[model samples]
Target chain A: QKEVEQDPGPLSVPEGAIVSLNCTYSNSAFQYFMWYRQYSRKGPELLMYTYSSGNKEDGRFTAQVDKSSKYISLFIRDSQPSDSATYLCAMIRDNYGQNFVFGPGTRLSVLP
Target chain B: DARVTQTPRHKVTEMGQEVTMRCQPILGHNTVFWYRQTMMQGLELLAYFRNRAPLDDSGMPKDRFSAEMPDATLATLKIQPSEPRDSAVYFCASGLTRQGRNEKLFFGSGTQLSVL
Candidate 1:
């Protein structure tokens, strides 16, 4: 099984709606969780980051990590057309140096 | 804004040719990473370096793929005898430290490679 799993969603939402993107993983060793946003032809950009099992908020984006369930989520409030992009979840162990594992991103489109 | 820089924004090479992609990490960032993105495989970590020293590269195919950080400023990923399946966008990202899990990664636009 892949270390991380996410729905390859082409989810569409209306402007001003709330958007939630999620991922699940089988590796309990993953302690660092992150969310990245990538527009077409662009590289993944860091959106939100969290450590262990907790929530971190940044502007309109909220990242939640549940270590017990090995699940992570990113919530966007009052979404805008500019927020339309692919959201990717990534995880790594907390050790000094470790490689990251990324999930298949969820594509989101916010329409007017 | 300090950003990672990658060369040859787009590359189209014939199969079995040697392909080399380069990256210049953000100044002062000690960690550099190479990733491959494809429609079916999503994003795969091919290799990473810490302080110009390789920490992990198991994700890469040892026979054909190689990664190196010859100096603090440059990192490279080379694929020889490239196959058609090697066609994908290659990304380079740099981080400040290996200690902070929350440390933000600065990414380059990416190198779109097509092996025909």
Candidate 2:
């Protein structure tokens, strides 16, 4: 199995709808979880970062990590058209200078 | 205002030619990473460096790809004898690592490469 798996979704939703994106990993050693957002023709940017098995919230976005199930999720509340982009789930084992394993991003389009 | 900078935002080269992509990471950030993004491969880590020394390059193809940090400010990824399959966007990111933990990464706009 791949180290990380994410559905390549072009999930469409109306504005103000709640959007949930998820990823599953097979590596139990993975410790740090991150979500990145990328716009068309732009590089990915860090959207959320979490280390523990819980939820971290920032404004309209929340990131949840469940180490027990090896699943992580990103929730966008009251989504806007500006939120349309690709979301990628990335993680790395706890270590010094270890490389990251990234999931295939889910493309999202928040309609007007 | 602090962000990673990459030059030659777009590059097109014939196969078998040498291609070099350059990055100027955020000052004071000691960790640099190179990643390639494609529809099929997603985002693949090509290599990464810490304190100007290569830490891992297992993700890179040894035959035609090489990455180096000749100095603190600059990192370069070179592909000699490039192939059409090498067409992808290359991104450079920098972060601060402390106490064996990686910090938030700041990314560049990326270099769009096309190998004909």
Candidate 3:
């Protein structure tokens, strides 16, 4: 099985709605969790970062990690059309210089 | 806005031809990485360098692929006798390492390669 799994969603939501994206992993060794955003024809950009099992908030975005359950989530409040993009979840071990493992990504669209 | 820079933003080549992609990492970053993205694989790390020395390249296909950091500013990924299966968007990323902390990576726009 793949170490990481995410729903490849083309989830459509209206503007001003709340959006939630998530991923699950089987590797308990993964300690660093991250979320990246990618627009069409562009490289992925880091959106949210969290360490271990806890929640981290940045403006309209909040990242939550539950290590025991091997699940991670990203929440977007009052979403906008500009927020339409693909969301990918990534994880890495605490070791230095280790490469990241990314999920398949979820495509989202916020309609105006 | 210092960011990783990749050359030949798009490449199209016939099968069995050689391909070379380049990257200019953000100045002062100590680590550089090469990655490929596709619908099937998502994003996969092909190789990485720390302090201008290769740390790991096990993810790359050794027979036809090579990665090198010729200097602090330049890194390259070359594929010889490329195949159709080698088509994907290749990305370069750089990070400033810190002990006991997770490094934040900044990625380049990437080179979209099509091996016909």
Evaluate all candidate structures by whole-model CA lDDT and list the values in order.
0.90, 0.95, 0.92
Best by DockQ: 2
Ranking by TM-score: 2, 3, 1
Clash pairs for candidate 2: none
**DockQ of candidate 2 against the true complex:** 0.83
Pick the TM-score winner.
2
Whole-model alpha-carbon lDDT for candidate 1 = 0.90
Residue-level lDDT of model 1, residues B1-116, one tens digit each, is: 88899998999999999999999999999999999999998888899888898988988999999999999999999999899999999999999774444266778999999999
Better by lDDT, candidate 3 or 2 = 2
Chain B, per-candidate TM-score:
0.95, 0.99, 0.97
lDDT of 3 by residue, B1-116 (tens): 89899999999999999999999999999989899999988899899988899988998999999999989999999999899999999999998877834488888999999999
Worst 10-residue lDDT window for candidate 1 chain B reads: B97-106
Which runs of model 1 end up more than 4 angstroms from their true locations? B98-102
Judged by lDDT, which candidate is best? 2
The iRMS of the candidates, in order, is 2.0, 0.9, 1.7
Candidates sorted by DockQ, best first: 2, 3, 1
Per-residue lDDT tens digits of candidate 3, residues A1-112? 8999999989999999999999999989899899999998888899997897889999999999999999999999999999999999998888877888899999999999
